[model samples]
Target: MKNKNVFNYLKQLHADNAEYKEQMAELKKLPHEYQVVYKEIQNFLWEFTSGDGMDMLQPMYGLLDFFKEGAGNQVPVLDLVGEDVGEFAETMLHEIQAKTRINELKRKMNERVKKEINQNK
Candidate 1:
């Protein structure tokens, strides 16, 4: 019974990891404009989940608003260009990977805790 639970948990973790990896790969292939927004979303989500010192949803939505404005021609192209854009892109990608690892660690820790609980029971 314990083996079954362990196996199921591992399987779910693997699936979740794979799905996130695929999503990241797809995001990487997007054009520069869309990619920036996608990366920001990933960053915000990761930071939010990992107890970062920021209002995740608000900043994320704000970024979305910026993207939307750009798309609608309300924001100029210069707004999303330059060295800052490159830096942001790099930082966002790094955060995504970091967050993925953190989530995996958390999942493993939870599994360990569950195993202990089950054994105690």
Candidate 2:
């Protein structure tokens, strides 16, 4: 007789791995800053993975609004299962914008400091 338990376990493992690979591929397609944001959101989602679906709803809706602001309004929230994966995508978009703004401020501040030092020299 076939060992159905081991066979099922192996099959399930393969399916899980495939899903992970697909998600990785999607992340790789994003710009570098957005990829960093996606990973951060992934970490945030990790904690809620074992929690109830209700717990994720608030965060998911917050994420959906982030997407809606950025042209991802078309992303279907209902079609997503478990914790909404849209959170990862949308958070990345918003985070990347924030990072860009911060970087610009840093550059301007650095330029001012350099100008001050050059004047003192």
Candidate 3:
């Protein structure tokens, strides 16, 4: 059973790698500005990566597609990302909900407050 689980994991990992390569190839076809912005956003978000970070890939894939369509219509990268980049990245992190450190801290703080209130009651 343990071996089977390992095999399954390896299979999924290989498939994911292949998909990532394909995504990268597609990304390369985009304009330089788009590529630079994409890499910047990717690096920023990676710092906040939670767990294995597999949850983050789906959003990135979507972001790439959105960028592609916008680029196709001649939309500037800055326009797609807005004037504020960091805020945009934070917003994306919130939407991902991958049990980040900030989220964990918030959860802990709430629990502590709840416990305190109950004890006082």
Best by lDDT: 3
**What is candidate 3's TM-score against the reference?**
0.82
* Residue pairs with clashing backbones, model 1: none
Candidate 1: C-alpha lDDT: 0.57
Clashing pairs in 3: none
Task: Write one digit per residue (lDDT tens) for candidate 2, span 45-98.
Answer: 544343232333335445434433432444333332225556544554454343
Lowest-scoring 10 consecutive residues by lDDT in candidate 3? 96-105
TM-score of structure candidate 1: 0.40
* Candidate 1 lDDT over residue span 48-121, tens digit each: 35444222333444445556556566555346544466566555545444444456578899999999999999
Encode model 3's per-residue lDDT on 28-55: one tens digit a residue.
9999999998888888777777667676
TM-score of each: 0.40, 0.39, 0.82
**What does the lDDT come to for candidate 3?**
0.87
